[model samples]
Target: MNLIKKSAIALCALAMVFTACSDDDNDDKNTLGDKEGILLVTFGSSFPDPQETFKNIDNAAKKRFAGETIKWGYTSDIIINKLRQGNGEGSLKGQIIDNDTPQEALEIMVKDGFSKFEVQSLHVIPGEEFDELKEAIHAFKEKYEGVSVKIGRPLLDSDADIKAVADILAVKFSEELKDGPVLLMGHGTPHAADAQYLKLQSELQKLNPNFFVGTVEGIGFDAGTTSIGGILAELDKLSPKATKVTITPLMSIAGDHANNDMNGNTGESELSEQSWKERLEGKGYTVNTVMKGLGDYNEINKIWMDHLEDAE
Candidate 1:
């Protein structure tokens, strides 16, 4: 009887040991982090490219500001646009909304107990949106009382920063591109876009004048389509049939303007930018638009890398 009892106790002990080992293995397999805490903030991503573009910024932040959690605070427009575009199942470009605003995003995070935020704007310039964001961030900080938040600078803070970005932009054009004119597609706004594009165009030309450089906006350029045609017309006048045009976007990360306005083909609206390539071809010039974003380039990635330091 004593031997049987001792054998039963030994069997129970073995079962308990096996159960503990199974639990340990299961914990290892499900190694994911908790989302209640992190660092960093931005407007919001409507599509994957802009989201991924910001992700590139986050990745840079990760490399330099290691040992910190990076959290994203996105506007309701991103959520709504994403959902209306079939629950974020489709491309992010379709995620833009007419009524989207920024203040509510920070409010959502604060309501959820976020105490600190490095509110960075992905806006290309310090124009209306950036100005509004700066004010909203300030209001949020003042209202929160115990929390901390700071607004980061725009992409057009200074020309050295522009050259830093332009030098980064320079790497994308190959040396073979020396014979081909490199045209950058920028969102020429009624406000600062022309000045910014002019600055970027000058910097790229300075970097390498072996290629001609020009920019046309989605709006604000005098005779919008004509500016592009004018550049091509001049190139045609100079080189005739030998013109090799490489068009790349000058915008912060080609979200909608790069993908839709520059590349879309059905010629949707008269207000839409007539295909620059089609226009150049009509003038007998060989046209090629480079469909890549500045954010993805290694050197372009350095822009955020340079800024993350100030983030500290």
Candidate 2:
């Protein structure tokens, strides 16, 4: 072959090799690595005290899955916006809190070399928030090919879960049960999963007649079975007539719903929108409030951890 022709062929072959190498490099950049990460997604609370509940869950997850990358995601845009705007009430007031949404958190993990993720939902029920988290994860997976993600179910995903939570509550509120009825106020949803509240109530009643469950939104399979009015009716039916009641939140964190809707005081006027405390007081019964979340309880947190383990 002529020297000029051979030289030209050699140069072309070398250029093809370089092109292949560049393509390989680009592929490597898009592909995820072998590292695993845990993303705990919650509806999120703007209240400062509830932030501790998230911290507790994060710490527990880190302890359980030591050396694994762990991060948090807030599913609620309203809470995220409030925190970012420094409009968060109480301790969060005037302090801008930078928290990531589920999508952003997952992207951060991917950038940090996490390829496998166990996305756990810290929601009380598999309701709207939980559904949105799932959708976000789905979109994330579509955006990032070759990444593996498994989602942990919410706190109450099945009848077994309801029963398990009921058992925990029975022990958690044993002392309150002795005094009189213990009312648990959950953040109810328009979603069908709201019926889980009724199932939980039934389970708790089986454990102790003094146990009752209600919702702030007054939604469920039967609103009458999961609302404050329903609780009042049941309270009246309590044999021997209960003279006192203890109210507590069934949510992961005792934030706005627990503080305002369940236990808020709206002055002495009988006409104002009544909180659970005021309603119970108006019923002529001694009422007490417990401002704590389910996450505050180790056993309840363990249940969530178990769900994560199952997902893994």
For TM-score, the strongest prediction is 2
How close to the true structure is residue 298 of candidate 1, measured as C-alpha lDDT? 55
Question: What lDDT would candidate 1 get against the real structure?
Answer: 0.59
- Our model 1 lands, by Cα RMSD against the true structure, at 12.5
lDDT of each: 0.59, 0.85
lDDT (Cα, tens digit) per residue for candidate 1, span 78-179: 655665556653455632223234555555555555666665555555666666666776776666565666556657667887787767667768654665
lDDT of 2 by residue, 1-312 (tens): 599999999999999999999987665456677788888888888888887877777778878888877788888889888877867777764322247898988888887788899999999899888888888888888887889999999999999999999999999889888899999999888898888888898999999988888899884335533778878887888789999899999999999888888999877675766899988999999998889899998888888988999983
- Cα deviation of 205 in candidate 2 (Å)? 0.5
Model 1 misplaced stretches (Cα beyond 4 Å): 1-51, 73-102, 210-226, 237-242, 268-273
Clash count list over all predictions: 3, 0
TM-score result, candidate 1: 0.70
Model 1 residue 203 distance off true place after TM-score fit, in angstroms? 1.4
